[model samples]
Each structure stands twice: as C-alpha cells, then as structure tokens.
Target: MAAKDTKNIKLAKQIYDALSTEFPDSSCSLETDCPQNLAIRGILSAQCTDKRVNITARQLFDRFPDMESIASQEPEVIAEIIKPCGLTASKTKSVMAFAKKMTDEWGGVIPNDVDALMEVPGIGKKIANLIVGEVYGTPAVVVDTHCKRVMKRTGITDSEDPAKVEKDIMKAFPEAQWISIGHLSVDLGRKYCTARAPKCGECPLSSFCKRRI
Candidate 1:
C-alpha cells in the first residue's frame, strides 16, 4: 500500500482502540433475539429512534405473536400496530413483505448475505449489515446516521453517503473491528458527537478528530 494509506490505517487503529475502551461492550441498540424479529425492528427504525422501535416491536409481537402471524396479517393491521414508529404505511409493507418472503421463500430462514437481506423491502445496506453482523456473527460495517456523522467528524471518511462511508471504514480498519466500530461510534455520537453543537471539548476523540464543521 501507499505510505499515506499505511499511515491512515495505523491512525485508524489508534482511534478504534480508544473508542473501544471508552465504550466497551457496545452493540446494536435495537433489541431483538431472532433474525426475523431484528429484521422487522430494523424496518421500523428508519427515521425513528431505537427506543420507539423497541416499544412498538413489543406491541407488534404481542399482537401478531410470530412470523407466520405477521405474514398473515393485513397491511392495515400491521400499520396500525406500528403507527407509533411513524411511516406506518411503508413500514407495514416492508415488514409484511419481509415476513412473507421469509416464510414462503426461505422457509423462515434469515439470509446471511447482504444482497439477500436487501431484497426485502425497506432493508437497505445499513439494516443488511446489522443483520449480518449481529445475527450471523460476520464482519460488517453498519453505517447508520450516527456512524456516518461520527466517522466524518473523526477524519475517518470524507463521504456523507453511507455506502461510501462504509467503504472508507472497511479500508481504514481491520475486518474484526468493523462491527465494534459501528457500535462504539454510535455510543460516542450520542454522548459527545451530537449533530448540533457537539461536545467536542469533552469528546475522547477530540484530540485527533478533524472536527469538520
């Protein structure tokens, strides 16, 4: 590799180690045990907070009970159940479609491949990576909004698009650190690197962060 690229990778590792220490045991905020449940929760999380998604997920599961029950429900019913998470109509379609696909096509098996997850409606690269990393224990860079903002401010990437940010992170850090980086960045993003008027002075990464304005 070029000398400049090599230096960046070394720097990235330093940042990773620091953040990992600061936010040990970091993980996806969405609470779900099963892949199918996680897939549904991810769909509900778009433009929504993890807290709200988790609350709505409990209500949804209570009403529907299982994947087969969810697949059999009318779109209207699903929408009504998840209305608190917002974008009810679209989220409902995505959840139902995903459930049906899992039931009819994969025999209730969640695909470990990103492309396969993306085939489900509302399952974008972010959710796909989350599922693969969490459910399948695979290396994945889940560039959600918090991840995108924190990585850019930390001088990890110049791109704002999630796909590009994911690429930059993958290149800068080792595969084993990919999943942990996402969670650590998110924890930092929420506590110190907030979108507006970030608490940079108190941030652990402030010393090295570009602090892009």
Candidate 2:
C-alpha cells in the first residue's frame, strides 16, 4: 500500500475504534416502523432536523397510516401536516408523488438499490444510501450534512461536497465499518462537531480532528 493509504488506514481504525467506544449503538436518528416509513421520513428529513422530522412524521403517519393512505391524500393535506419541517410545498409534492408510485406501481415496497430508490421523488443520494444501508443491510456510506461536517473536521476527508466525502470515507474505512462510521460521524457532528461553535475540547475525536470549526 502507498504510505498515505497506510496512514489513512491506521487513522480510520483509530477513528472507528474511538467512535465505537463513544457511540456503541449509533444508528439513524429518524424513528420509523418499516422501510416504507423510513423512506418517507428520509424524504421529510431534507433541510430539517431529525427531531423535527420524527415529530412531523408522527402527525403525518397518524393521518395517513400507510403508503396507500398517503397516496390517497392530496398533496396539500400532507403539506399542511409536514409544514413544520419547512419547504412544505415541495416536500408534500415529493412525498405524495413517491407514495403514489410506491402504492400504484411497486406495491409499497422500497427498493434497496441506490438508483432504484433515487427514482422515487425526493429520494436523493443521501437518503437512498440511508435506505440501502439501514433497510437492506447494504454497505453504504450515508453522507448527510452531519456526516459531511464531522468527517471533514476530523481530517477523514477534506472535501466539502457530500458525494466526494462519501467516496473518501469509503476508501478510508473497511466496507463492514462504513455504515457504523457514517452513523458515528453524525453522532459526533450533533454532539460535538456542530456547524458553528463546536465544543472541540469535549469531543472524543479532538486529538485527531483538524478542528476546522
């Protein structure tokens, strides 16, 4: 292996081990009962906090319990329910359209492949990867804003673009550890490596982080 590759491998191991100890049971923050629900929540989570998404999703699911139910409602109705998540109009359209396809064509089954998932309205690369990683147990690198921020700050990747960040992290870590590190990076971002005013001293990865904050 190249010297830099060997160094990155060692650093990746150290990061994985450190974050494993810090957040042993890290997982996606969104709460859902099934892959379909997870898919909807993932869409709702765009430009929104997971806590808000979870809260809004409860109201959304309460009104429209399933993909069929969601498909039946008008986009306006779903928009009203998810308004708290912001960008209600677009989110509603995406959810309604995606739900319609799920109900009418796919019979409410969410596909595990990235390309297939992207075919659904509002299901972008990050969300697609989440569904594939969490639902299908695939080796996926979920590069959400939090994952992007933390990884960059931690010196795991220097890129600001999420796609490039995902690719870089995939190379740094083993395939088996990709999902775990993705989840851990989010945890690190939320708790310590926050976008502004990060608590660098309290961060477990402080010693290794480039402290881009």
Candidate 3:
C-alpha cells in the first residue's frame, strides 16, 4: 500500500480537530471500572449495541458480581441473563470461559498485552485492541462498525476488513490519538454520519469528506 495522500491526511486532521471539539471528554461508552470487567464487556459488545451491552452487563453483574461468581456459574444461566443482547448461547459461553480463564490463570486481572488479550475466548483483534486501549490505556486502533464505515466513506481506507482498516487508520493518525479516535468516530457515526442516511450537510467534516451527496 502506498503512503496516504495529502488530501486524506488533511481530512483526517480536520476530523480529529472537529471531533475533539465535539466530544472533548469522549471515552469508551461501556460502564466499568475494572480492567477485567472492561475486557469482558468489550467481548460481549460484539455484534451488539453498546447500550444493550451496558444494560445487560449491569443486570448480569448484579447477579454474578465477580469473576469467581461468573466462572462458577453454568453457561446456561449466563445465557439466560444475557439473552436480551442476542446470540445468548455463544456469548454466554464466551463470557463464562473468559471469566474462568481470567480468574484461574490471571488472578482476575486483564492482561495489558494485546496478544494476551487475544488469548481470551471470543476476543479477536478488534475486541482485543479495544480492551487494551480502554482498559490498559494503550494506544490501539479499534475498527468497529462505525469506524470502518466512516473511514470507508471518507476514503481513508479502501478495505472493509477490520484489521486492514485498523492498520490504515493507525498509519493516518498519531499514536497518541488512536484510543480516542475510535470513540470519536462512533460519535460521528451516531450523530451525523449514520450508516443509512448520513447527514452530510451538517457534518463537521463536510468540507473534506468524500461521501458528500
């Protein structure tokens, strides 16, 4: 892949500036204080909305409350609690398995390393990066649906693959901004650049966004 063009770089900077003004306090929307909980929440957030994950996690956590509680419980029970988030069976197994591993092996703390996070069940590159970034305060590009859509629409990257998109975005933005850029892109996706009907006219990046229609 060739280096990013000047126009794209300028657009990225504009986006960064605009989003910084739009959401100065932007952070991962998941409501959790512990790194282990954040990692589990990020995994459960896959193919599910953050709002739903927050709700479901709150209820589920109220019942289980800790890694030991979750690790000891049956997957069926976990699935029952998380059914509202969809994909209950698999998500439940994943959550339980992840908790068990963390409790048994890591003493209930999430590892700061990306490769270690990927070792957890149901954690892929995207979720792993999210956990590392949000929990560990490490700089990582989290290319979720919103980030991928906005990046593609703005011509920042040509690929739909999350890994490829992440790499492209990491190359475009400075390392210090990677963790916050994911949340900013998500905010832009929700508020202005929606997947169905993006509000191009009112978007902050309208001056440079290639998807203006």
TM-scores of all candidate predictions against the true structure: 0.96, 0.95, 0.95
After superposition, candidate 1 runs with Cα above 4 Å error: none
Per-residue accuracy of model 2 over 1-213 as CA lDDT, tens digit each:
787667778888878988899998898889957888888899999999999999989898887888888888877788889999998887888898889888888876777679987887788899888888888889999898888888777777889998889888988999998778888888988888788889888888777766633
9 Cα displacement, candidate 2 (Å): 1.4
CA lDDT scores, all candidates in order: 0.88, 0.85, 0.85
Candidate that beats the other on TM-score, 1 or 3, i.e. the better one: 1
What shift in Å separates residue 38 of candidate 3 from its native position after superposition?
A: 1.5
Q: Which candidate is the best by TM-score?
A: 1
State how far residue 103 of model 2 sits from its true place (Å): 1.1
Instruction: Compute the lDDT for candidate 2.
Output: 0.85
Model 1 global lDDT (CA atoms, 0 to 1): 0.88
